[model samples]
Target: MSSGLIDTKPLAGIALASAGYACFSMQDALVKWMIATYEVPQILFMRSLVIVVISGVLMRVRHHPSILKSPYRGTVVLRAALMLIAWLLYYNAARSLGLAELTTLYFSAPIITVFLSILVLKEAVGAGRWIACIGGFAGVVIAANPSHSPHLIPAAMCLVAGFCWAWSTILIRLVSRSESTLTQMFATSLLFGLACAVSFPWIWRTPDAEGWMLMIGLGLIATLGQFLLYEGFRYAPASALAPVEYTGLIWAFAYGYAIWAEIPAWNVFLGALLIVASSMVLVLWERRSEISARNRAAA
Candidate 1:
């Protein structure tokens, strides 16, 4: 494993992850709405189509000419498969779970991502990152305020979805070392789109004007979110960005309030404060680490 100055750019990764999560939270809100009327595969297929077009158009002529000829094809394919599984399971669970419950359950991902960063990538994770991830999780639980209802099946599906997504993120950091962002996006979205297409025909619901608008918006948002998040991984290790994932729950709450006029209670504010504070602490800690790393290099 080759790691260069990965220690110095944690803030960039954290910031990008924050923005990416906000977009994802919005995407979730849209999916939560669309799932009520359309099938999961259909929604994903549409989303993937937009991502594919954007990635394809933005890909440079100077980059690798063919996705098939890539040296990391196997790893990229595996990552794409995991992502497809993650979205499929997540959307299916969305059909039965409330957005709060869905976000709460998926919050388990940061822990999984950090653990994999340690075990798989052999990255040295600091106590500050660990503390942030744990604290942020506490905040998510408070903010989302999921029900204790034993909707066992959907709950289980959500946990699995989180794990798959977390693993795919690790793969993202792994490939970011060598893969072009556009190439990965193009390959992942292309493969993702094709996989979803297999079932798209069976579950197709002709979209009305509003539905078309929403799906197109979903695609554009997905592309931007993936680009930022993937670029973040290029600058910082996955473990450092793990805690940032919790911020999505905050966005989920905000979007919920905006879209449904659902007023969050006191717990939401408290959780938001903790989430923000944990992120700040991690940012300050990372700055210290980067300075120390630079001094050592200078020495």
Candidate 2:
């Protein structure tokens, strides 16, 4: 991700992404719970409406009554649309796919983001960062323990979802440069609500009291998740934070085990080690880069 220009606070960005991903993993869990009872559009419409109301109020209070018309308004809208597509593909696939399998396929997003960062954002990705990305995905594959005979269609959908998410990550970096966090967030939520509202009437199954709780809970979690993630792109380059997305796998497995009593295998331990090491590598790399820049400035 680039705000047209990437500043080099990789460590901070990584931290924010790490925290943000934990929230995302939780969001996925919440969606998985309601997918059986609710259509994607219904869930998204409700969730987005919550975010819109919350962010809109905060936007007015924090800034002004007027929406800050970003020059990247088009890009912001595109990002929001991409995320909606991602949720649709991902949640639909979740109906047929196991959690581990679904996440394994979607984990491809980081590598895609890294490549896209180099290609789209024109960021100088170091060999270390590439190694970190590879190592982290290797960890995810090990930890995921994807089924051997996963349905091809759902698997493909997961990959497409990952790609959509990767594209949105780039957009976050670009838009964050010009748009305030609240403005971009409000814009995204508003668009998401409107788009999902289209089919919401047709698919509407009135959420019962329990359903209402879960949906509102989903919206709150998503609001925090989106905020932290968008703020992350501000602190670090998209390429730099890409590997940190792998940390979500750690949270994902944790949630699975906690919720479903899925015991961890040997591979989980092995994979977690690699993922942690890969993060360390990125940290060291960023540290070195920062020092070098300082030295160059002094010289």
* 1-299 per-residue lDDT for model 1 (tens digits): 22122435778888888898889889988988998888888888899899888878767544445667767789989998999889989888877887678878988999999999999999999999999999999998888787667389999999999999999999998877677778888899888889888985588899999999999999999988998888788778898899988888788878988999988899889989999988987898888998998899999
Deviation (Å) of 230 in candidate 2: 0.7
Predicted structure with the largest TM-score when compared to the true one? 1
| Root-mean-square deviation of every model | 2.4, 2.4
lDDT of each: 0.86, 0.86
Local distance difference test, candidate 2: 0.86
71-133 per-residue lDDT for model 2 (tens digits): 787897898889999989999998898867887899999999999998889999998899999
Assess every candidate by TM-score: 0.95, 0.94
